[model samples]
Target: MKFDLHVHTRFSKDSDADIDAIILHAKKNGLDGFAVCDHDVTGGGPFSVQRAAELGSDLVIIPGVEISTSEGHLLVLGIKESIEPGLSPAETILRARAQDAVVILPHPFKLTSHGIGYIAGLDVDAVEVLNSRCLTDGPNNKACAAATSLGIAQVGGSDCHVPEMVGISYTEIDVQERSLDAVLDAIRQGKVRPGGGKTPKVFVMRQMMKNAQKRTAKILGLD
Candidate 1:
């Protein structure tokens, strides 16, 4: 099945896109499922999931959070509470594990955040080898290498804040069911595949534009 595991909504400080808009974009793009992985918060999941159900879309809205760690950004899926950022990566993973959530490293080799190299020693469930926002091929390759060396499963996502970018990079999983447990099991069993690449210049430019937009919005008090 095709799934975009990383997404953001207005609940995230950096994104203004609401869940409904994101869902509509996903449905139009012909995605089978998507996850609403807001930063540090899973509050948007219930509403998004309910909306997806109403639309008669095969969309499986998985609840998740992208947590900021001292080392890097981590995607915690199947979470039901707000996780605070600024914790160590290890600690963050531990907490997520306690909740039976899947802990994944997002853009592990990116320059802005702590990469997999720093958190390799920590226990993690999966590695995001192909992040839509990862600008450099090096980091994406590095993520693949890390997952290969560690014998961990690899997953991918669009890391989309804008609705149009959803499914740009996606994960293909082999699972009998479409529930959260099935997805998590697919990751654990290495039954996942990454299906895209990103160029460094394009990635850097996109981040710059997004940052500029956010700054402009804040200055105008539009957020």
Candidate 2:
């Protein structure tokens, strides 16, 4: 099954994408499943899963959250509740594992929030080698190379905050069962491949501009 393992929704302070709209778009775009890894929150997970099941009927919604650690961002998947943020990446990964969750290093070289600086020895299940929202392929290449050198599994996600970007990058999980736990097992067993094309430059640039605007607002205490 195809899964875009990273996304955000209205629950994220940086996103306003309606949960319903994102699932609909994912269906229209031909994705079988996706994870809603909103920044620092999973409050919308149950609602998004319920709404998508009602709409698509067979689509899968893997409860997930993109958490901010002292080191950087981590995608914690297959967990139902929010994992506290601001812990060191080591502690964060350990906690996620305590919940039987899967951890992925997302956009490990994408700079600032998207970058995790150095993850040389962190015990993570996968590295996000392809994040469609990256400004260029250089960051993706760096991530892919690092994963190769580290001999760890590599995956992909859109890291999207908008609907149209949902499946621009995804991971093809080789699981016949199509259940949440099965998918997590697929990731853990490295039965996955990073798939999908680049996001449209226009859309990528637009999102970048939006992030810049939000950052500016935050700096000025306007958000």
Candidate 3:
């Protein structure tokens, strides 16, 4: 099954794409499934999953959240509840594991944000090796090396907030079923493969937007 493991919807304050729009784009692109991993929220998961079902589009929606940890970012899939940020990466992993959710280290080697290096000693289920927005090939290779050294599964995601960028990167899992649990099991069992390469234009635009948002937050005293 082809799945885009990381995507953001309007539920995230920084994104403008809605659940419906994301699903439509996925379906249009011939993807089998996608995850709605809005930052720190699951408010859009059920809505997206249900909408996909209603459309009879064969698009499986995985409930997930991209949590901002003190070290870097973590993507928790197969979750249905909110997990507050500011926790250490290890603490966050434990909490998510307690809820039977799968933990993923997102862009650990990326220089701009909290990365896997922040919680290197902690055990994690998977690591994202091919993030569509990775600034350089060097970091992507480092992430792959980390996952290999840790003996954890490696996956990929678009980390897409914009409509046009969906499916730029994805995880290919050899699973019989398309359910959330099945997907998580495949990842845990290391039955997934990553695929994607950086698009120069998209990479630059995403970074610029991130910087602008950070500056805006700082100015508003919201950072």
Candidate 4:
């Protein structure tokens, strides 16, 4: 099964992707499933799942969150509740584990995007070695190398904030079933490989600028 394990929707302060649009585009992108991992929020995941069902789409919607840990970002999958942000990465992982969640270190070397710098002792279940939002492959390469050195599972995600970019990058999982449990279990056991291509640089830049504008507007109380 092909899955984009990181995505954001309007539930995220930085995104405006509609759940309905996201489901439509995911199907168009040939993805079997994708996780709604809105930054620091957990609501988008369930909302997306419900919306998919309403649309009669069978795409698997894994509930997840891209937590803003004290060190950087961590992707916690298979969880419905939000973990408090700003905790240490170790502490955050512990909280996710308590819920039997699968934790992934996303863009671990991309300091500009809040990537957790050194992943050696993080105790994460996987490392995002292919993030489509990366302008260059340097960060992704470093993440891949680190994961390889640490014997950690490697995964990929579009890190998309919009519906159109849904499957720019994805993790191909070897699963017998297309259910959420099977997908999470596959990732936990490292039965996955990163696939797909990077998002175009122009598109990535446009999205970044849009997010910046949104933040600026909010800061000025104009949003």
Candidate 5:
């Protein structure tokens, strides 16, 4: 099964993509499933799953969150409860593990994206080596190399904040079943491969500008 294990929805303060629109776009892009790892929130995932069911779509929506840990950002998939932000990476990972969630280090070398910078000694289940939002290949390459060296599973995601970017990058998982547990297990067991092209720089730039505008508007109380 192919899954874009990193994506954001309106639940993420920096994103405006609606769950419905995200689902349709993911289906159109030929993805089997996608994880909703909205920043600091897990509600988007279950909300997306429910929306998909309401739309009678078969795409699986794995519950997840993008945690803003002290070290950087981390992806926790198949989590039921929300993990608090600003905790240490180790603490965050420990909480996710307590929930039997799968932890992934995303853009671990992308300085501008709050990447964690180092991969050694982290107890993550996988590493995102093919983040579509990475305009340059250096970060992704470094992540891939690090994962390979550590014998850790490598995954991919669009890290999309917009609907159009859905499925730009995905993880090809070898799973016999289409359930959430099956997919998570596949990822944990290294039965996955990263695939897809980079997200167009123009789209990325546009989103960044929009985010900046929103922040500025909030600061000015004009939102």
Candidate 6:
């Protein structure tokens, strides 16, 4: 099955894609499932799954969270409780693993997002080698190199903040079942392939402008 392993929803504060639109676009993109890795939040899991059911859609919404670790960002799937942010990457991975979660290094070379540079020595379960949000190939290629050098699993996702961007990048995994656990296990076992083109430059600019406007509104108490 194909899954966009990293994505965001309104719960992230920096994102605006609602559960309904996320499901709609995932189906439109021919995806079998997706994970909502809301930044520093872990409450979107059951909500997204329930909403998909309500819409009569069979898309699997995996429970996941994107942790803002002190070193960088980490996407952990198959875990529900929110791990406190700012933990070192190793500590974060330990906590996620305690829950049998799949730990993924997202945009591991993007400086602005705090991509930690030494993932090849970390105990991560996977590396996001194809993030749609990465404009230049440098970051993505660097991630790929690290994954290759370290023999870590590789995956991809849109890391999208808006509905239209969902599934712009994804992972093709080998799973015998269509359940969440099956997908997570597949990723952890390295039975996955990264796939996706870069997100359009226009969409990237639009997201940046939107974020800027939101920040301004919040500062002026107009949000």
Task: Judge candidate 2 at residue 206 and give its lDDT.
Answer: 77
Best by TM-score: 5
Q: Kindly indicate the candidate among 1 and 5 with the higher lDDT.
A: 5
- Judged by TM-score relative to the true structure, which candidate is superior, 2 or 5? 5
lDDT by residue (tens digit), candidate 5, 113-220: 999999999999999999999889999999999999999999999999999899999999999797988889888998999999999999999999998999899999
lDDT of 6 by residue, 1-223 (tens): 8899998999888887888998999999989999989988888887999999899998989999999888788988988677999999999999998898889889989877667866767888889999998879999998899789889999999998888888999999999798888888788789999997889989988988899999999999998
Candidate RMSDs in Å, in order, are: 2.7, 1.7, 2.5, 0.9, 0.8, 1.2
Off by over 4 Å in 4: none
lDDT of every predicted structure (CA atoms): 0.78, 0.87, 0.81, 0.92, 0.94, 0.89
Model 6, position 115, has a per-residue lDDT of 78
Q: Per-residue alpha-carbon lDDT of model 2 for 89-134, expressed as tens digits?
A: 9999989998999999999998855589655898999999999877
Give per-residue CA lDDT, model 1, range 57-172, as digits (tens). Answer: 67888888888887668898888777799998888988898888878878887766456454367677778889877655788888889788888778888888777777878888
**lDDT of residue 182 for candidate 6:** 84
Ten contiguous residues minimizing lDDT sum, candidate 3: 111-120
lDDT of 3 by residue, 138-192 (tens): 8788888877877778889888877667778898988999677888888878899
> What's the residue-level lDDT of 26 in candidate 4?
94
Greater TM-score among 1 and 2 belongs to 2
Per-model TM-score on C-alpha atoms: 0.87, 0.93, 0.89, 0.97, 0.98, 0.96
Candidate 4 lDDT, 78-100, residue by residue in tens: 99577999999999999999999
The per-residue C-alpha lDDT of model 1 at residue 32 equals 70
- Which candidate gets the maximum lDDT versus the true structure? 5
Candidate numbers, best TM-score first, in rank order: 5, 4, 6, 2, 3, 1
Report the error of model 2 at residue 131, Å. Answer: 0.5
